[model samples]
Target: MPRIPRTKSKTGLYHVMIRGNEKKNIFRDSEDKDRFLEILYYKRQNGEFTLLAFCLMDNHVHLAIGEGTNDIAKVMKKITVSYVYYFNKKYKRVGHLFQDRFKSQVIESDSYLLSLIRYIHYNPIKSGLVNTVGEYRWSSYNSYITEKSNFPNLIDKQIIFMMLSNDPQKAKQLFIDYMSKETQENFMDLTAEENVIDEKAARLLYMNMLEEKKYKFIDPIPLNILQEVVSQLQAVTGLSIRQIAFITGINKNKVSRILRKHSKLQGD
Candidate 1:
């Protein structure tokens, strides 16, 4: 079947996402991330687009951008190609670095635009990379909150800030308040919604495992059972090590050790 065309953004604004091939880490180190950002900044010199927000996770990236002199496709192509070349050269690898076609959703309203920005800013938190949005260094959230960001002019915050309030300080405060709220609001994303298991489900999995094994006591679980429990929690529930530890009352380090050992055993 032929490919479907991307939905055209009437307002020339979109929420764009791209990930590494097979869900691998795109930026191996800080230098790699810096280079990618450098390319992103360099591409904008032509005035082809306006970047509003961005978050660089290990394996993927989220961008809120508005088309100016060129379409979003052309803008993304320039940015991705430049970075991929640098990435492949540095790693002494070849072939595609990015996955299939980049995903995007049209942002035609101010409400949706603000929500998308919030979601993009919150990506690191959602992925358990950082506990707070302010703690993450690779996002545009700091740009909105601070006047002295590393790349202050890379993103255009005027429109979003104005929407929050006429007063700059008040707008910043409001933006912070809005971000602080716990959100169940969903938006377009590459990861399937079902893939992320919540705390309740994770705990249920642990409880059910103990009951199945006819084990009454939670503490001092047999060594073999502990390994199986940790490995199964990861394999079956897809919960992170921290989450698994929380659910099973296991030390996070022990959980990591179990998974690593299990993986090594499987490899052998």
Candidate 2:
């Protein structure tokens, strides 16, 4: 099945995620994480990308960045390839280090931009790896709050600062307060949307699975049962089979076959 091409962002900003192969640990130690960050800074200096926010996890990395001269894909390719080469050389191993392709979402609005930054910065805390975002040394939260110049990483702080307060000190205080808050209703809401999308994709795949199993008869199925299944799937995922198949590389004909078979079973 052909993979659906990802949509590029017109504004050049994206929320990107790259995971280790099979969700294995990506960072072996502080050196691995530091090397990745160093590569990121090098790329930024060469005008390949602009780092907004980032979080390095054991198995995955999240980044909020603006594409510079290079597109998001190109930027990611360069970063990952360089890091993978270094990692393999260091660990005395070979082959791919990252998963098939990185996941990305175009930031379409200011609200989402801020939310994504917070989400990325707070990943360690949210994953139960840390007690607080500020305590996560690998993330950009320290730089943002402390105004530390050690990293030389570029971040658009004015937007978030303004959202907090007009006064710089007050803005910093507010930003800290906001991040330190234990509640994550906003983050959970955003995650729910992704869950819905995943559920829909899974249901479509299940239909494809049925077709692969080759259920004997596909005709004379009851419409009501088929409709109920599809409806339940839609309610959970908010996507139609067409959309799911398009994204997931499932055959539309196979999906139809499964639906038809289920319909007949319900009728009987």
Estimated TM-score per prediction? 0.70, 0.66
User: Judged by lDDT, which candidate is best?
Assistant: 1
Colliding residue pairs in candidate 2: 221-263, 221-264, 222-263, 222-264
- Which whole-number lDDT from 0 to 100 does residue 27 have in model 1? 91
lDDT of 1 by residue, 15-58 (tens): 78889999999999999888988887877777988999999989
Q: How far out, in Å, is residue 267 in model 1?
A: 59
Residue-level lDDT of model 2, residues 94-143, one tens digit each, is: 98899888877776544456556767877887688888787788888887
How many backbone clashes are present in model 1?
0
The true-versus-predicted C-alpha distance at residue 40 of model 1, in Å, is 1.4
Find the candidate with the highest TM-score and give its number: 1
Superposed by TM-score, candidate 1 places the C-alpha of residue 147 at a distance from the truth, in angstroms, of 1.8
Candidate 1: residue 165 lDDT (0-100): 81
